[model samples]
Target: MTRHLPSRRQALLAGLALAAAGCAPLPRAGTASASSRQLPQERVRAAAPFPMPDISVPDFSASRRFPITDFGAAQGDQQKTSAAIAQAIAAAHAAGSGVVVVPEGVWPTAKIHLKSNVNLHVAKGATLLFSERPDDYLPAVMTTWEGLECYNYSPLVYAYGCDNVAITGEGTLKAKLDVWKVWYARPKPHMDALVALYHLAAKRVPVEQRQMAVGQANLRPQFVQFNRCRNVLVEDVSIVDSPFWVLHPYLSRDVVIRRVKVRAHGHNNDGVDPEMSQNVLVEDCVFDQGDDAISVKSGRDQDAWRLNVPSRNIIMRNCRVKNGHQLMAIGSELSGGVENVFVDNCHFDNAGSGARSTINNILFVKTNERRGGYVKNIHVSNVSATRIAGGVLSVETDVLYQWRDLVPTYERRLTPIEGLHVSNVKVDEAAFVCRIQGEAEMPVKDVSLRGVTVAKVLEAPVSTVNVQGFVHAA
Candidate 1:
């Protein structure tokens, strides 16, 4: 059964995080409908079916304890509030406490760095409202993504290379991301002030000379970033209106995310992105995003050439994707390859059209023009989707930069994907055209489809004759 453990530790921690972040005491849990119809009980899957193999992650439960903070009560600009909260967390860590409290209120602000072994909890009715003012998110940090270094907007709640960490609560954490429209990077200033944001990013003396604003990019940033973290838990929070990707667990392991709500329409506003990570679990979450709901990626081309990790052992269940690109997406970043992912009991409806853009692919995996690794061993079942405009299944690769002369040469030592299984998949509307291709040298092998039904059928069908490791191309 899909149980709602609203009062679980994660939720409790979310509530506490909000209080510490400076929100006021919550009135009552909002009664807004869950945004989508509940799927048949039989359709939902359990987390236990796909076991969590051993991975590296510290148990923060045994780390020094920390208390939450309230950002609303602090006076002066958002910098003051953020600084106060930051000090509180740092003090806790120095005292050997790992938890910091986030009190309730409409706490306004910008970039706030996260500490190690700290649990930032948000309470119900508490909202962390980030300011649209450009000067708020200041300074530059040399951060990496799947192992790429490009200057961009910093995450609102930024944490890099921490262990045994978590964020939980039942509250509204708002990032007035659309406010970026105020910058000059955009064409028109519509709902969000992107033009003003461009101006903020346009302070182009260059980081080599400019001190604080070196790493500001034109693209929006992730709201939550766990870069190379271990033993992470992000549970039971209502994360709304993110500026970019909501919950990103990148290059980490033994991560768990449950009962989280992320609603954002900003460019590249993915709900959850696990890049080059291992042993992950995402369950009972609701995603109303502008981009792919949940995406897995490893480095891309030149970036991929260096990273030595692949995403593996990923499990997802009882999750819903409302306005998104793909409910699940493996990527163009397959330079390091992806594998061992199981997704089931998910609902995708009213998707494709959202606040900002439309999605082009669902169940999307790409490795265009460039090749380094393989994507394989995926199992999906009991998924129901409605109102989708993109290709139902697209397994081909693409190259944004056209390189006509570059030959597509593959490798034998690649982590070739095998053992694919899909069943009980139902889609309401699809136009046509579904291509599930493996490398010509490694055309997907060993695929099984049982009790699978699609409302619209494409001319092409997926199948693979299997013996040992089945790698179905569908």
Candidate 2:
């Protein structure tokens, strides 16, 4: 359904040929615009093989500024800065609409909670360095670990049930990873705690009662999470380090993350994770991540099914990745279905990397039998990469990392993956072109590849176990 004309010349020729054959020419690019902003929503919708909504971000041009320094925040003191930030946020929220400003200096702080119609704007020469102490985020807040919902440590910047929130500026939001670096190691205690949480979620325990900040749970908090919010925008910020996933839009809607730069190399430091969210757009971002550059996820098994909100109408374009496991990954935690995702004009530039640092794949769709979600209408086009360590495309149905031995499967429901199309993807070197290991009962369906050229193949170009309607074109 999705078509990619690699170059302008190709597009022109294709249009001319279609006209000569008396067929309607391809729809011109950028015909439909969203709101007054210049985001190419029309192009995104055109690329998608399904219906996509017009995504828009919060506009704060008329908001007043409430600087943290005005509320007794100093550069060296953490307590004073944290209090000042809270006070500034309160003042801004009370003023109907405002921007809580962190001005030009290194400001140490703890958890920052955003309210509705508030913009947390860090100025050009400023850095909001989050504290490393676990106590700084104490008094557990409602958050998710991996994909399960619980009350845990609050993210560094947390937004809960707020509308029209924006975190925009030309500054940096960094984390002090002294304690989190140690928590990255999944010891026996950590694994046990995860199993306990899994059991709790499977049994449908109250989310408020599932406290995980106690004991050796070590479930590191995310850097920034828009939890249960609407009209979110995070733009032009440089994120350095993170405790977990860098930018997370969780159960939020109408989100836009653009012109941002992230360099986080922690345990599971994905760049931007849009989980259980709809109408999301991530464009013009540069990611140097420890995990996938952009991971599309819904909630986990039982928790996701209870919520029943599928992640859909998402688009990622014009992004660059320096280091990652994959350019984009869909679900190892997707139980609440994911569909209508379009990734275009993205590139992975990992040329000067060591062997262990090369990307594994361009696109990886992974789900196990425990996850009952469905993945469909995934389209990727015009993606180029320097080198891929594994393959260009991979769809593995039995990808349970540690849960296989740690805990028993409470419910067995296989994911239905179908309608995956990739076109005009050029990689310098790769282990293979495609590797699909689908289940016998429910094979992956309707996968097609066109113009997927790899310069060097370290292994077989294509491998499959159980797949239906598979097509490949050089």
Candidate 3:
């Protein structure tokens, strides 16, 4: 007997009620709770266009401090500092809860791995200059490259299966890109390696065996990744020049990334990538990136569907973009699904001058037939931009960058996109106001635009292919 599956509408409705079903009143920040010995919860209450729960984040203000200097970390010494950071982190975790402090100095390090209940705090006037050698990130860890899971080179700062971890302070975390700059080129060898990884993921090979850190793979590691961790926080840190994505929260939950500044213009250097994560809040951050400022993603096609964890209840507000392809981009790697995202009160400050400007759409939702997931209830409001290279809103259903020809479809399933709303957005100039290139079978639905004023439109005001229930107002 053939079993019946829920229709797209049913799935979307179920997702809409997910937050309300699992939501509970969280304790305010700094309050003691039953899990106080673990990570104390802090309530994050923000007004969203859809139903959302108050996100819980880690609070480490009153924790004990373990200064790296006390652990024999010396300025300008890479090996000693790296060992010292590890020691300090171990000490903090052993103490149940503590902050691993990096004192005020320019210290070179290899990789800093965070543990549970440990906040790696870089103090004022401190800069952690990461090493450029590839060997420093050896011994492949569980990480994802472009949404596909693998045991690749460890990220510069990685946390795996840890609860209540953070990286906070008024200092800079910079990457020395001497080697990573050359690895950015996608030559024939790199393309072949990506194809191999794709086939492995499609075949459901064990993540342990799908290593891409070998010779000529050139898969750049993210600067910071909180992998499968809970109650994560990264606040008030300045990041300069990353190998890849600046800040990544992958398969994690209850994350808060606030007041961070990222200036990474290297290839594929997205500012923040919240991939397959839930209940995340990114606020009051500044991004000058080489790719999208905020790219929300789930996993890739077969691997993502196997994981079956959709990114849900994400909110990004009061953020500023200096240069990026989009203010917020969803998908092109989303197969697990994405829903109930809210982007509010963001500004794209003159996105660099002249030819350097790269601002694109305010909100771009992109997927293809292989994605096989659903996107719904995405809302963007109160956004202001100087000049948009693309448009205000763009929903494309046939966006498979190099995979269009690089790899064949292992499973063919079209994405179901609906309930996209944008309001109170003003841009000085744009190619269009709205562009929708939806498939005929699954036309984009319920797209509403209100008070979207494009001062200058270089092309048609609205361009659409297959869209339903499209409402536009002045």
Candidate 4:
């Protein structure tokens, strides 16, 4: 059984009292639905059994701490601090294992490249404020943009081919977003560049030759990325503002992100994106995002098929979402299969400012015919929400946003999705209970819902097309 938290009523009372006393208060963290809190585990088990990896926090108690002050970094200088951090990382690498410390001050810097067996620890009063100039991330490195691999700007914090890495301590990692906010709009040049990159990937061009960041591509790099690494941990950090998706783990394994709070309201600011990875866990996190709170993805079309990796064995629990498009979302770019995802014991608080105040969806799984993938054995249970704009559960296979007219579909391939289970989910208000649409040739199948209750629903109870073997009870 999932452990339930305090009710929304209690949280609301606390907030009101704090407001009366002229103190800022947190939004309500709701409790699990009473109808589903005692759901049986067997009803939500996977179709086939698989082994879960043992993921844990790294131990750095015995390692030496290398402070950046020892390497000529001042509190207000960007160039000197950036070079000093690189030197500290090199020193830690030479020492086999160590923690590079950023002491209590506002340190302005450029891109930080991480090495193996090193922890970038920002102390309690420290803040790493990244530069706003796009050229600071110039001389493109090997990275991916929207599921396609290319050479682009380096991420703010990047780790490539490393192991046993971490970013911990009670401080903030922020972005100076003067340039990135303007780059959000998709103009003609950006569209043309996207089309060019897609054709390049489809023709199996070398990653070196598939260079982005040319002719107004505007592919923003992630805030922090771990590419082709293993055994990672990111804990106890407050990330406020990002260039793109925050905390992305791509092509990695055995990752854990716990007790991390993120508030990124810029465009494409997903709190955490686990792409083409395996054996991950995210727990005890608080998110206030512009996009999905947590989005699970595999990869894009031909590139994903060539790489042939599936994201599996992921779990999320005890998380609180203040505002987002969805509390949890699956890909529109999942050509590489996704499976064995379990989410439980979470709260979605959708109390926002004006008439647009609500979460778009509680849970959403989106794809299109051009995305050829397989999704199986996804289970969500024991969740509660308030003020949802869309639906409690939504599965659509025609979500082509800008690519609909930007690039023509080279090959039409439908995804096969099955074995989805949801139980003990309750919502105070929503547009619909479920809105599911699938392809006619290959319909979504084997879905089960039990003990789902809603106080008020504006739209239909369930809206579906091309779905089979669906069962709903009580």
Best by lDDT: 3
Write one digit per residue (lDDT tens) for candidate 1, span 235-336. Answer: 788887766568878777668888998887766677888888888889899888778888888765444444457888888889987778888888766666
TM-score of every prediction relative to native: 0.73, 0.90, 0.92, 0.88
Q: lDDT per prediction?
A: 0.60, 0.86, 0.87, 0.81
**Candidate 3 off by > 4 Å:** 1-37, 351-355
Model 3 lDDT tens row, 136-240: 998777789999988788899988766788999999999999999998988899899999999999997766678899998989899999887778889999999
Kindly give the number of clashing pairs for every candidate: 73, 0, 0, 1
Query: How far does residue 3 in candidate 2 sit from its true spot (Å)?
Result: 37
Candidate 1, poorest ten consecutive residues by summed lDDT: 33-42
Clashing pairs in 4: 36-424
**What residue pairs are clashing in model 2?**
none
Query: Candidate 1's C-alpha lDDT?
Result: 0.60
> Which has the higher TM-score value, candidate number 3 or candidate number 4?
3
- Candidate 1 or 4, higher lDDT? 4
- Candidate 4 Cα outliers beyond 4 Å, as residue runs: 1-51, 351-358
What TM-score does model 3 achieve against the real structure? 0.92
